[model samples]
Target: MSFVESRAAIAEALSTVEGVTGYPKRPTTWTPGDAIVLVEQIDHTLGVAWQVTWRIVLLLSGDEGVAIEQLDELLPLITDALQPLVYVDTATPEAVQTEGGDMTAVVILARSE
Candidate 1:
């Protein structure tokens, strides 16, 4: 599935769980070689629905090196919040350098039922 579709599915599934109210998409910014898609979900429990955010990033192979360690920092929080219904099964980041720069990297965010 595409990154946006995967993000939406994760948010929607979380909304169906207990104390969940709704999931809304969020704005994201990145460089030309970077793409990020985010979704925010709110759950009403303890008198207020908690907000949970999920992000998927896609980076392409570029001439100059690019760093996205910041995403790694926030991943734990996302994993912790979506404990019950959503989880990130796999994350693979690679760099491919060819004669014609023929390389691309995919970042997948999966949520299970």
Candidate 2:
């Protein structure tokens, strides 16, 4: 699928997940990738948007910071959500920011995992 299509698919999938997971509904957006910043918006809660970076997609959960090991366990769940749309390269650790609120995730998908 094209970038926009892929983004849309991912976003749709995330919405379903949110509904089933009982997470608050949030607005989302996507930016076309070029030479830099190859990312697509998956979900957005508040001003914080969940994005998929090209090189790597970092995913997180819980109110407190998640450890690397814990993150590893969560990858399959994300992959399960994304695998149907397209191939997703395994997620990697990116910047984990805990500034104003609880911990969230930013998944970066290159091609497939």
Candidate 3:
């Protein structure tokens, strides 16, 4: 699939997780609660196939402790939802300070070809 199509498919898969809001594109305004943001990280030609890497940011609005707890709860669900769609290479917790608020983000690296 093309990169755009792969991204859309990944978003669709992410939306299946309960209590998680999936964004195909970055939102102008952040959501109030838990959400997932899909970002295209890189794309390169691997032999005849094109490999696309996507950064799936799982975000929660709260302090580090609480947000980490919430993200921990959601991680398995997110991985399960993504398993059928893409190859999940890594999922790492990160502290992010956004204009909206202090947030915890689980940055997931996934790839598709």
Candidate 4:
């Protein structure tokens, strides 16, 4: 599939996760609760196809402690949801600060051909 089509498919796949609120193509406005943001990290041309590495960020809202706990709960679900479509590379916990408050993000690296 083309890059745009590939990304759209990834977003559609992520939409099926039970606890996820939404999968946004870009990180513009923050959603009220939990949401998934997809960012294209890198791309390599593999002859006729391109291998794209995507940063699947799970934005979690609430207290730091609770958000960390929630990351543990949600990481596997996100990975499972993406398994059939992409190769999950790594998942890491991150702390993000916004004007509103502190938030947590589980940044997952996934590769798609």
Ranking by lDDT: 3, 4, 1, 2
Worst 10 residues of 1 by lDDT: 21-30
Instruction: Supply every candidate's count of residue pairs whose N, Cα or C atoms clash at under 3 angstroms.
Output: 2, 10, 0, 0
Error of 4 at 43 (Å): 3.8
Off by over 4 Å in 3: 32-46
TM-score of 1: 0.34
Put down candidate 2 lDDT per residue, 48-111, tens digits, no spaces.
5444444333335433355454555655665677567656655545444444443444444545
What lDDT tens digits, residue by residue, belong to model 3 across residues 35-82? 554556655586676677788877775677777777778888888998
Clashing pairs in 3: none
TM-score of each: 0.34, 0.45, 0.84, 0.80
In candidate 4 the C-alpha lDDT for residue 78 amounts to 73
CA shift at 68, candidate 2, in angstroms? 4.4
Best by TM-score: 3
Give lDDT: candidate 3, residue 30. 64
- For model 1, residues 4-106, the per-residue Cα lDDT tens digits are 5655655554444333322335324223233344543334456543433344444444533333443354345445645654566655665544455534444
Choose the strongest candidate by lDDT: 3
- Which scores higher on lDDT, 1 or 2? 1
Off by over 4 Å in 1: 1-55, 58-66, 94-106
